[model samples]
Target: MSVDSDPDMFSSQTTVASNWSKDERSQKDTFNWAMEMMSHGQYLPLKSQASLNLEDLQYSTKMYYIRQARLACEIVCESIAPSQGIELLTQVYQSMKLKTAETKKKDAVTDTIISAYKKAEDYTTKVQILSLIVEKYSKSELLSFIEGLTIYKIDAARKYASTHGPGQYVTPPKITRLRLSKQKIHHFIEFISAPCYLQVVGFGSRHLKLSSGLTVKVPKVIRTMIASRLITAYNNYCKDNTILPPCRATQYKIIKACAASQLKSLHGLDNYISDGMESIDTLKKVVSNLGTKGLQTSKVSDLIQSLDTLKLHLKNEFRSHLSTESDCSQHCMHFALSEKGCEHTHSNICQPCDRMYQIRDEIQNVMTSNFSNIEIQEKEELEHDILVSTEKNLGLEGSFY
Candidate 1:
């Protein structure tokens, strides 16, 4: 299937090489140009007269050779078994030096088979890749994929396989779309790219179910809507208005890439998810989990406001008396020996360092300590332990006396 091994496909005639003195690049150009001119598979002829004339003069090959090669590529490729195409390409390329008149004709024919083999390889690979990526595509996606390849790829279809080439054309010539205005396109773009599309936007997003039975929980502060929802909306709007909208590729590109600044990420809900909110949710679940799942906390919604308490405590209670230039060294020099300041080197926190020990202790209590039993039971247990110790000491005192 590979074309690189074939010798006759790009053979240089001795007379032409010696007299005309064309380089290897010129040889390749002439060979490809000749093959293209004779090809039936939607090859575009040189349009400009100057370009055409330049090619004819530059190539300067026999018409008979071009004809034989073209016929071998288009007519002969189909006439033989597909396996024969590869075989002929290999056989003629290896055996023929193409110095004599007969060998030159063999060389030209072999050149044709090379093109045929290349087409075969290209077709096989195209099918293999398309098999994997062909998903549930809306009409918009198909248009974007084949945007610029208008007549070229279509013309390159298999003519021999079917009775009619790619079936009959359905549309009338004049009714097809020509140029779409950017004026109309901007409407769709602006609709999807805006912060909030409907009246319910801003302040907070309320969770709502679409008519299609999909649930959308948008971000309270930022946009958390899915891209597919917007794409579906665009399609419906375009259909209702009888107007052409941009393809899904264009719509997706605008949001994911083109308008990435306006719309931050793909998963709309991830943008505003803070650790504080998550902690509050976890605590609320724990409170509800108590009482054998009967739920004691009636005001679970107010748990969200606990973040404000942490902030207030940090702002009001943490009184670090040290100035900007006064680092740990100056603060701890009175209580420590090392110039590195009071490393305080305590188990929990540094004393007189941040003055936030109470806040730290409270945070640790909420996060790690269990508050299941009431404080009354703990106080009773401590009192019992002290009384027992006192009794034991009194017995020892009596023995000493």
Candidate 2:
């Protein structure tokens, strides 16, 4: 019989054909959905869970999932409404928290790795773990955490190097390189002060460039190092014949002497009169003893006696000057307060004493107008003179003794 005419046979064949077509269409849709999910990074969680055992999951794989989740959250926030995106992000954050908790459950292994990284003894393994942490965490947090770790590590390394001798327990080159790259130069500079810093500078002199451009402060211990370095450089220049320079050791002794002299001066005298007298005596002695060898001893003695007479005359003049200043101050106070017809006088209340009051007011006005400028000018002049004297002294030949 013809298929079109045979109703039962046609109905059975149509049912079989419809079932096969539906099955093929379902398979194609499933394949396409899986491909789409993979393209959007959505298939990793499912694939990881299904194909990998919990023990077989690598740290890199976990980090990949974390990164993808963060990126997906960001994309959703940007492309969709904020509220909906926030809700999705919260779920992603919860997932991250769970993953972190799972990782933390293996505390013994993780702690071992962290300890190794901190000791910096296993360079390759430490670097790997550090890379993983840097990749997984925010850079700001990573940097801050590393900074604190570095401080402890530096102190420990210093102690270890000191105890074992530098040759025996030197910091690993790789760790040093990494630390230098990560550390701020200023902090490193501050950490390395003299005596303690001598070895560091000796090793890293080429790497260090201390200049005005560096705003980092030098500590007191290192200030001596800076001074010594400057002195050594000047000495080298002197050796090259650029200028005459004093013996550095002798200069140091001179500085000590000057400090001692200043302390003595502070406590020994109310004024510098004794210092002036002592200087004059020293000058007279030097001049007398250092005179021409063949010259008459009598002439030298006469010169010294004349210097003594001059010194006595100067002391008398200074005393007289001080007495005059005291007398003038007393006389001025008396005149301003007790002169006849003075407005300041208790008995001169009549006639208002307008002229004297006016003169007094004028004097006050003049003093007020000129005093500050006069003091400023005097200070400036004194500073200029001191600076000139210093320059002249520096330009002179320096004594080694």
Candidate 3:
């Protein structure tokens, strides 16, 4: 299982008091539970405790992973990273039968240890025993090595044998300041109030009533940012002024703190959402009136499916027949079929196709007229934008977008 990436956060992972059973519990069990709580950057832990099972060896009402984690670290002597140490402890967990949580039964690792012990008895003579298992000095010494495999005593012994020293580049990288000065930050606050970034809250005269009984109006962040757009603007400004910009995270934190309670961004999807509702409402009105004597009864799904099929079919259709030349077989396919089109003048005009094209165009015109009515809304929104730039300063005029 993956361990927490930022080990420093929970560095002091000392456990609260618990019974001796806590000491017997293996590191693997505790690590898995801790992993479940670590969700990316948000460190939210679930309150669900593992209920007691009578078959458990280290049986306790409450088992804290904090305590188990500390013990695992101590066993590894801090030589390994906590993640590496967890892997080493897993071998310990598998071999030590007493260390197994509920099983009291021996596992494969434990069985391997037992077999190695029985095999050691045959290595009775000192020199023969040395030859049998790759030239070890004594049978008793060899057996100790085999048993130490379970508890990782061998690893503990070799900890300093491979100790790493500081690298050649000991000096820290020289730091050039990138933090926005008080004036720049103040300029940033003013820059963001520009027409492109923010607008007045469109609530008109209406005031937001709080639980504290305070009434206030909020501003609309014009774009779905203090987003990429805001950052890009900041970087551009810094570049033009021949100064380095602070990191994105730093800028984000500063802006987020400023807008925490009062500002809300106007989402890009908002227009589509309103348009979608209007389209759905129009379709519903058409469907609802179907029962009246003049109208045909049909589902919205059926209409949509048929429309999709017709659109594909119409696009693929060739107006080869409309070509003026009688021998224009190759050139027929080249004719761009629409209300009007033919590289070759019409040898024969298609009345039926012409009528169909006219009807299609008419339907398109009607749909476009209905949908494109949002031009006024768009103009109004643009008017609401706070137009503030080096060249143009149209100070905060309208309420919101």
Compared with the true structure, all predictions reach lDDT values of 0.41, 0.42, 0.41
| TM-score (all chains, Cα) for each model | 0.21, 0.24, 0.22
lDDT for 171 in candidate 2 is 57
lDDT per residue (tens digit) for residues 229-279 in model 1: 667666766785697787787777655642222334423332222332333
lDDT of candidate 2 over 1-401, digit per residue (tens): 79889999989999999998777765445544554464474433323322576357788887775675565456555455554766766776789876765554323544565565677766444444454343334434344445445444334444444555432433546632222232333322332222221222222212222455654432222121233443454455345445445556644543332211111231242234444455446545443433442335765676566556645433332222121112332213334343354333233221211222332233234334434454566435534533443333222111100
Residue clash pairs of candidate 3: 195-386, 200-399, 323-347, 324-346, 324-347
* Per-residue lDDT of model 3, residues 99-207, tens digit only: 4433334447545544654465432222222233322122334444454432232232223223321111124479886656787677666655654344444543334
The list of candidate 1 runs beyond 4 A from truth reads 1-180, 195-226, 229-247, 256-401
- Clash count, candidate 3: 5
- The true-structure Cα RMSD of candidate 1 reads 29.2
Query: In model 2, how large is the Cα lDDT of residue 304?
Result: 64
Overall local distance difference test of candidate 1 = 0.41
Model 2 — TM-score against the truth?
0.24
- RMSD per candidate (Å) reads 29.2, 25.7, 30.5
| Alpha-carbon deviation at 70 in model 3, angstroms | 32
